[model samples]
Target: MISLVILSFTVKKNYTSASTNSFTKTINTIVIDAGHGFRCENGCRHGSTGENITEDQVSYEVSKRIVAELKKKYPSVKIIESRPTPFFVENRARAEFANKNKGDLFVSIHCNFVPKIRDVRREGTRTETKYVYVGKGKKRKKVKKTITVPVYKTYYLPNPAHGTETYVFAAHKTDDKEEIIMENGDIFENEKDDSTINNNINDPLIKQQVALWTKQFFANSVKLASMMEEEFTTLGRFSRGVKQRQKGIWVLQATAMPSILIELGFLSNSEEEAYLLSEPGQQQMAESIVKAISRYKELVEKGAPQPPVNNGKR
Candidate 1:
């Protein structure tokens, strides 16, 4: 089991002629969000045994590991844990904490599952892949061979489609001023952005900077995800690739900072569930998180060398 302890640190800042207090350097605070709670029941089960692994327990365990890792490596940085224990945090509270702290980043951890398909793939221009949950004592489907893209990194979760993934949304580019035609054919202004937010995307320079930063954040997340996979692999877990999701998710949408929700592995997988609940597995995950954060800090200070330049149209 990992420990959560909060510490304080100060930043140095120089004062300008007119300012009484000026911060010379910015001290970043990271908000670690562990999704779901132990008390809530979602009908979710462990993959390998079809046993129950409550969301609270999983998130709590993962969060504890993550916090411990961050503190060990980034002692100067402030870490505000959203869920310290199993009973106190919820999605709304998590968002509120970030907002209150003005967090530099937010990360929510989770696990994934495929209850429908066991493990099947189909070839396409690239390749189509599907994940199926294989229950205990259930020999469901034959492995289908096709040219589809592998859903996960092979280092950790080797069976296929069982591994870690990260994601970010493509920038919203629909013209803000454009009128929306209702069913009656009446035009109404789109209100996603009012006048204040409009200026952000309207400025070409601002848009470029935002896009660049967001991309960099995504790359950083991928690096962390890869590191975690390696750590898990060393401890004998599946390695899923750092993935991108175009669709909006709750944590992604709510986070004020660029964020990623990692589906570490499926509790639905019996073997995975047992491992995740084990002390060694948890420690491996924690160590991976620490390593990833260390790498991320380096990239942030020096800049990601291979930053994705794509405008996200693809």
Candidate 2:
């Protein structure tokens, strides 16, 4: 951390990763996004079908309950959900709303499921019957007999994967995300050129500064995500480890704040689907997330050291 601070002042402007924000901003408002509220026809579409539930439904339910829990636990903290109902909400719209409201943190709630496989692998015993003639005594005659034989089969099957995962933006998408932060909504174009926002694209100083801030914010997002995984693991859920996804998910990258996307569990798994739809399971997950946020707030607000970089490509 000390070395990082030294590099911020002494390093060349083109060296983007070394510099960092001079101050640690406290999180006062958090924007919660429920994944897959909209269909492709409506604008935003991100979801998977489960055995008994849908991603859009589960995400909205979980997000609504999490908001309830957050309100109960942190009365002073302002909480906003990108979608309170199952209405269509575009990803860009969600990001724009959070940015317009000056949200400090963005949390996207979603459910993960292995897509049902059309090329399914199968294995089972097949029934076989054979007719044979056997007689001993005075006369031999064809007799009716049924016999069962063991058989085997092999084929493809639907994936039954289940787990919990957390994600931050990937590094390869840094430039695109930086552009979003720079030009999306209040990021640029409309923002008046000041010491913070610079119109001169050639001047690498402010660009570097913004880059450093986003890098550190990415670091903080990892910290919070790790804490969340730990909390979920403690609750006896399978921890798929924190992930870095570059494709498909856009809201996290566009927002001008530290962000994370939580994959609660696989809806494709029957047991997990039932659990996620239950009152008890939803309450527990919401509480665990709130606890993780509380811990993150305590540590980050106290100016903890920047977490070591562990960005991944996938």
Highest TM-score: give the candidate number. 2
Candidate RMSDs in Å, in order, are 17.5, 9.9
| lDDT at residue 22 of model 1 (Cα atoms) | 16
| Candidate 2 structure quality by residue, lDDT tens digits, 1-314 | 12222223332333545534443546678888988765657565458877777888888888888898888887888899877778768788898888777677889999988766655344554565666678777776777666655554545565678889999888777776677655632333332322233344345665666577678778888999999999999999999999997573688788877899999999888889999989899888888998898888887778643532434510
In angstroms, how far off is 124's CA in candidate 1?
Answer: 37
In model 1, the runs with Cα more than 4 Å from the true position are: 1-27, 39-52, 88-92, 116-161, 170-208, 303-314
Q: How far is candidate 2 from the true structure (C-alpha RMSD, Å)?
A: 9.9
The TM-scores of all predictions, comma-separated, are 0.57, 0.73
Tell how far residue 96 is off in model 2, in angstroms. 1.0
lDDT against true structure, model 2: 0.74
Model 2 regions lying over 4 Å from their true place: 1-23, 38-46, 116-158, 184-202, 246-248, 304-314
Looking at model 2, which ten-residue stretch has the lowest summed lDDT? 1-10
